[model samples]
Target: MAASVQRLQKCAVSPTGKHTASVIFLHGSGDTGQGLRAWVRDVITPELAFSHIRVIYPTAPARPYTPMRGALSTVWFDRLKISQDCPEHLESLDSMCSTLGAVIEEELKAGVPKHRMIIGGFSMGGAMALHLACRYHPDVAGVYALSSFLNKDSIAFQAVEQRVAAGQSVPELFQCHGTKDDLVLHQWGEETWSVLRKAGMAATFHSIPGLYHQLSRPEMELLRSWILAKLPPDGP
Candidate 1:
């Protein structure tokens, strides 16, 4: 295991003591797993309330973020900039993907089927989810990204293309972005969804009106519904 993966901090909620399915959500740039601890405890735990589901939030190790002039920050991967025009830093992104892949492998070893696990995140975390799910773990139940965008010519697209050629299953994607988002422009998210569909992935894009870069209750509620839909409880 890489040093970064070894140092990953994770927060989990498994109140029902059952692990029939799992949801691993990633946090945005500079945010740790504990950063989302409160939300998972207060909001997500109650909203989903599935006795068989387990939720895991993993924190990224602190590293030099190129967008911030190399200042250390907790980011899944480094990028030159957060825009469709800027080319993605594939080297760093691939490294982080491998690290995250290790995390997923742990879950699979724990008895969770690949198709019963869902992966998603917010902002940069969402971008990482896309890369991980699309390129590395295409058999996951589904993937969601909030207030996120992908650069043009992303490896994710290429990976999906190869999957299509091989007749392999590709997970569905649920992408939600606020129209008022300033940091990650809404247009960028929209374009990313468009490109994802063009790449032969089943993607749904939800536009939240009058919302900002931060998450909103309404968006999360919708996400909760999507989650339950994708990972319904097992039959008795």
Candidate 2:
């Protein structure tokens, strides 16, 4: 197993010199916060260009991943497999949600309102974001997931159901998946969206034609627009 990063490699960006909103983005399995930060700097930051928006990239702790035959990886949680048909690893998921919840709690302590925060990520990270937005921090402004999916019986769905029954609002969801994605199939993404809708959350799905299981500039641009719409700058 490779050595793990003990500290989070947080890439904080506030373009306008003040932070009125935050976007916490996580990277895929086997990747680090530093890797995601580089991509955000090269792709998302340039397009987002919002001064009040502070983008944070957090790395997951290294752990033995079940899907990878117990090999160590920086994944939010363990999984039997990447397929939606596989049962979730609730114990690992619980721990990670608590870990990420602390991260959001820190933002709250810093005076950033929960409604002004957006949680998102790519691949496994995206799946974790969905779990957070629905199960742990449903009060967040929004959530965006790229090339991700959730099982039909995810804890997130149960949380959404309870929240809706209590007349509580849930964060809106924005999901992007490439139609040509073979790793996390497009059908799985669509099924996840359907489940979310049935669970009483407002969601949108974007299909990238001819694309694969990777990020694209157009996807980031669309995400920029969605983020702006969700938490627009306070004033001129």
Q: How accurate is candidate 2 locally (lDDT)?
A: 0.85
Candidate 2 per-residue lDDT over residues 28-108, each given as its tens digit: 999987788777667654644677888888889889998889999889999898777778999899888877877787788
Model 2, residue 41: C-alpha shift (Å):
3.5
Residue range 1-236, candidate 1, lDDT tens digits:
46555547798877485777888899999998878666555644354456777888899989899889999999988888766887888888888888888878888898888888899999898889999999989999999999988887888888888898899889999999988888447888888899888878898999998888877777888988898888888722
Off by over 4 Å in 1: 1-5, 40-49
Ten contiguous residues minimizing lDDT sum, candidate 1: 40-49
TM-scores for candidates 1 onward, in order = 0.92, 0.92
Name model 2 segments beyond 4 Å from true.
Answer: 1-7, 44-49
